[model samples]
Structure formats: C-alpha cells, structure tokens
Target: MWLLFLLVAAVAAVFSCARVCRAAVAAARTGRPARPPAPAPAPDPAGDDGHAPGLTLYEMAYLSGGPQRLADVVLVLMAQKRRLLLAHTGWATVVEPVAQDPVERATLSAIGPDGQRPIPAVREALVADEAVRAVADKLVADGLALPAAARPGIRSGIRQVWAAALLVVLTAAAAYWMAPPGTDTALLLGWFSLPLVLCLGTLAVARFELHPYRDWATDEGEQRLPGKADPPGSRLPSAPLAPLTSLISLALHGPSALTDPALRAALHSSGA
Candidate 1:
C-alpha cells in the first residue's frame, strides 16, 4: 500500500513539474508584459429595458466623474439619515434630510443642461437621452475607454500557485494508488516533491523579477542581469573584466585615472 501511494505521488509530481516548466519557458521567451485592462462599458441611459435612449452605465460614469474610472469608483455604499441614499442623475437622493454639512452637499451638486443643480436628475436625464446612449455605445465599440494596466507578475503568480497545487494533489493521489497503505512510500514521495516544488517556485520568482525593465523583443532575462548595460564604447573592456581593470587602474594611479588626459585621448582616438 505504501509503495503504491509513493508511486502515485511521484507520477503526479512529474506531470505537474513538467507543465510548469513548459509555462516558465514560454514566459521566458515572451518577456512577460503587463496586461492592459479593458475599458468599462458605458451604461444604457435608456434604462435596463432598452425602451428609452440613454447613456450606458459607463458613459454616465464618465460624464459624472463617477464609476468606470478606478479612482472615482467607491466600494462602500453611501447613506444618509440612517437610510441608504442612492445617487440619481448625479445628485444624492435621500428619503431623509442629510445631517452631513450643507457646504459639502452643495459642492457635490451636479450642473446640467438647465443649470447647476443636483447630479442624480442630470445623470438620469443624460442616461435616458438617446444621444448619450448612442455615444456610450460607440465608445464601447471603438475601445477608447480602457481602464488601467494590470501587472503581469500577478497573473504569473496565480499560475504558479495553481501549478503547485495541482502537482501536490496529483503526487499525493499517485503515491496512494501506487504503494501499499502501510509502507514508507508516502515519506519518499514527500521528500521527492520538495525539490520539484522548489524548482517551480524559483522559476516563477525569476520570471516575475525579470519582467520589469526588460525588453522582451530583444533582451532575454538571463542577459539582463545586474551590470549588464551595454558598453559605453569599444575601447571599454567587457563587463566582467571592467571592475578588475578599474581597480588596476586605480591602484597604479588613483581615482583621477578615470579623468586622465592619456585615457581621454585614447578613448577619443579609438572611435568609441
């Protein structure tokens, strides 16, 4: 029984590791770029029934500086007078009088076609207007209202976690099926999985670390390690030998060797 369990775990570990390794290789080649978030869709002011022509939720948000924009979107529900108050058109519509400062409320009022007033009514009117609806629809179709960029690291991290989990479950199951129940195979499988898991984790970390400041089209992650900047000129030695040469130069002369006349002359004449 133990032997069977270990065998199953081993098999699971192998497959999981293989899948993650392939993904890591692919990610390396692409030089992970941050994914751009899709823009929020404008709401249909014509209402949910589609009977009226109006702005969609997204369009209304844009005009009111409300939703759609990450900065403007509030997760918390706004309330007043111990009752939930919803914003209509662009104004806060409350059943009870607001106890909050009058000055603050006045400042938040929306300006509409008629004049400056509460926002809820104006928001509703625009959303219900046929022109707003058409514009909102067009905006979504044109793809002009993109939200924001999402970090590639996050996606990579998620993938890594998923891969690791799958590998663990498979390894455990394989070990159980392959080995006798009362054997040492479970321990063996556990030990084997440690190294495999570590390798996958390391690769995930490496990919994320290298993603930023990396030009995927040209430079691979391995080539862009610390101090891998291009040489300033041909006269300059290769990167690895650079520090030693600098030390030698400094030892022979001093820090001023960097600014020496002879060095400058040589550099200028070298076409570097």
Candidate 2:
C-alpha cells in the first residue's frame, strides 16, 4: 500500500540523516586540538619513529587542509624556493631536478615525466598521486585523520535524503491513482505526509562540518594544527619565515599567505 511505501521512505530518510549527524558529531569531537606536549627525549638515530617529535610540515598540511591543500603547500614552497617555476598564467616548469623529500618528488613527478605541465593539471595530478594519498594514509594510521572510507560527505548524504523524498512522492502518487472508487484516497495522502514530515525534520536537525577539515583531521590532529602565520608585511629573500616553517602558514591560510606576489598569483590561479 502507498502508506507502507511512505513509511519505508521515511525510515530510509531517518537512517540517512542519522548517519550524517553521527559523522558531524565525530568531526566535532576531533575538532579540538591536542595539547602541546612536554619536552621530548633525544631523537632515535635509526630514523625508526613513525612521525617526528612534534609534527612535520607535510603532516601539518595534511591535517589542516587535506590532500589538495597539502599538494598546494608543496607546490607553493617549491616555487618560493626556486626548485620550480610556476607562472601566474598557469604553467609550471621544474627548475631543480632534485627533490629534497618524498612530497617534493611527488609534486615534481605530478608535473609529468617531461617536467612541464599546466599548473592546474599538476595541482590536480598531485592531489590524486599515490604519494599524497600515502601521506593521508599515514595520518589516518596515526589516528590524526579519518580514513577515506569513513569520511563523511554531506553532498552524498543529502542525495540519499533526496532519493527517499522521491520514493515517498512516487508511492503517494501511485496510491492515489490506483485507489478504487470511494476508497478515500484523500486520507491515504494525509497518511503519506507523516513520512514526508519525518524526512523534512531529519534534514532540519542534521549538521556536519565543512569540507577538508572534517574530511581529514581528527580532533586530536586538529589540536596540533599551527595557529601562527607570517607576521604581516613579512617578505621573502631574507626568508623572514623559513621555507619549511612557512609551509605552516601556507597550509593554514592558503596562497594568500605567500609574500611573493607571483607565487600567490600562480598557485591561486591553479585553483589551489
């Protein structure tokens, strides 16, 4: 009966909205930053510790910005260091053949085998690169980031609600059209409205974190994200902010944090 179908749709919507709300709560739980730790002991000489004492620039970027932001951080730093040439017009050229780290190597590799590619192309390529994914995987392994499978996508969640709404509408229409004479189809329609009301209420109450932050870092991890930025009016060449340390600023504030006009223009245009 149409009433039954409406009830089923209502249940489906409730489940979907519940899932979305749970994700939002989980994100909120992880949204708090971890407290700063006491002084650390001497470093392990064999390079066996998983993550370094505090946090690496790569890890910081991953925590604050997710994969795409991490990639953008690397590209902007490389351009600042002159390891690569990134033009405001959206082209990238590899200036230095050697990469200092895995993340840099990944960026360079994403530029393609020929060492040249459009800035946007390279940005996209680097985001999906295995190397970048590896960084996210490591964070997840350390409990700093949510795993890919568990990441909450608000759009997808809303889509499920939409499907439920559609099902309810179709069922209600069918029940009305197929009713025998004097079957009281008006009452049937009113019953169906209950499920629709349920769906609408679920949507009204649900909440989720915005993208990237919720997509990546856990509460503990978010706590570790750097709160500093380059002091205003700071410029490059003198390296007012060390290049590696500066990645923190770039990660936190994005391309606008870069003191170099050309670097900001290039990466910003690349959709970083």
Candidate 3:
C-alpha cells in the first residue's frame, strides 16, 4: 500500500511539472526577440506640445520603465516646472495647485489635502487611480502598450506549481502513515526525493520561462515601436526643441542622460 501511494504521488508530481514545463516552453517559442529592428520614423506634426506624433511621454515611460516609471516622470516634470518640491528623504510637497493633464491631476490628488506625502505612498495611491488607468488605456489604444488579453501564459503555470507542492505534502503524509515502526531512514528519504525534486524543478522552470514576459509591453508592442522601447542613445533628438525632447528621453532612459549636471544632481538628491 505504501509503495502504491508513492508511485501515485510520483506520477501526479511529474504530470504537474510537465504541464508547467510545456507552458514555459510555449511562452519561449512565441517570445519577442531581445532586440527588435528599429521602426521607420513617423512624421511629426509641428507643435510645442509635449507629445510626439505617435507616442506620448506616458507611453514612452510605459515602454521603457512601466507605470512606476511614468509616475516618476510626472513627479520629475512637476519639480522641473516648479509645481512641486521633492525632499531628499522621498517626501513630496505641492507648490502649485494646478495640473497640466489628467495624470498630473491624479498625482496631485494622491498627495492629498495635506499638500505633502511620501513618494512611495503617492505611487501606491495612484496604482488603481482612474487618471492613471485612463493614461494606460490610451497607450493601449495607441499601440504603445500591451493589451491584457495578450499577456504571457504565467497564471496557469503558477497554479500548477502550487498544486504540485500540495501533492508533495500529501505524499509525505501518506508515506509517514504507511511506514512501519522503526523504519529505515534511507527508505523514507528515498520515498520523498522524487516529489521534492519535481516541486523544485517546476518552480525553477516557471521562473525561467516567465522572466522575459514580465515587461509591460508585449512582443507586438516591442516590434511596433522598437526605437521608443529602448533607452535613447544616438537616437536622442537635437532639434531647437531639444530641451523638451530631452525631457521625453530622460523619462524613458532615466536621469543619467540629463546634460545639465545641476538638474541631474537635484533629481538624484530626491532619492527617486
């Protein structure tokens, strides 16, 4: 009876691991390339508007650094425009009551009637915020961010791994119950080994396969806007409006790209 239970448990474990492995392999097979080709530049309509022809600052931030990055850019812009003050300790203070956009308004609301709050707390408050959601929806509609339906097959694989772990626990309990008094240690150890290996193996494979799909943009989004998806290098704009353009680049690429050392120092001092 003990041997039968052990065999059944081993089969169950193998089946669960196999399911996860297959999902992982499938995700890899359909995964996006590490470096997709640059897309042809689209013509820009002449304007001083912060948004480019095909992409907005929010979209660029999403492509490069996700929602949190978008939030960071909003905060940076607010500080640069002298509408907000950021302390080195991560607290933010509203200096201006006005907001330039919905995202800006949402960010201000997150800071609350107190007129000041920690950056992390503000970020948390904005996670489910309607204004943030509106920005994300626009990005998706504009082909800059991935739609929810197109995400990688991670949920099922995760469920399988948990199920396999439960099976391992149940198998161990059965083994203990069926073992005779003063059973040899080696026999018990051998009985548990297969299920343990299967559980660990499933988790490892899930992590490997699901890692690449963790980005905010999907394979389709990456392919469509390859240039915008990466950190700006030689691709940085040099027009008369370079200062405004650079802000977009900084939002996507990060503060290190700022030409103004003083501005960079100020941004870094905020501890963002």
Best by TM-score: 2
Model 3 residue runs over 4 Å out of place are 1-53, 140-212, 226-232, 238-246, 253-272
lDDT of 3 by residue, 1-272 (tens): 66776777788788877776666555544443434433533533211233344556666666666677677777777777788987666788999978877788898999999999988778677667887777667556545555444444456656766786787778777777878888775777577777878778778765664543456655454544435645564555576766656567676577676665655665565544
Task: Give the runs in model 2 whose Cα sits over 4 Å from its true position.
Answer: 1-5, 18-53, 152-155, 162-214, 228-239, 242-246, 256-259
What is the C-alpha lDDT profile of model 2 across 1-272, one tens digit per residue? Answer: 66566667668767877766666665555443343343433442211122335566666677767877787777777776788898898789998877877778888888887988998888788888888888777667566776665565554675676677777788888888877788787788887787677666656654333444334777566665545234522422235435544455676666777766887788878777
Cα lDDT computed for each candidate against the true fold: 0.36, 0.67, 0.65
Q: What's the lDDT of the predicted structure labeled candidate 2?
A: 0.67
Give candidates' CA RMSD values in order.
22.4, 6.7, 7.1
Tens-digit per-residue lDDT, 1-272, candidate 1: 44454454455555555655555454444433233323443442111212112323223233223122201111001121222233322333344333232222322232322334343343444334444344433433333222112224334444555665566566666655676556676476676567467545655664665343121111322231222232322233446654333322322222233333443332223221
Better of 1 and 2 by TM-score: 2
| Model 1 stretches with alpha carbons more than 4 Å out | 1-4, 31-182, 185-192, 199-272
Q: Which window of 10 residues has the lowest lDDT sum in candidate 1?
A: 69-78
Residue-level error in angstroms, candidate 1, position 201: 2.9
Error of 3 at 99 (Å): 1.3
Shift in Å, residue 89, candidate 1: 10
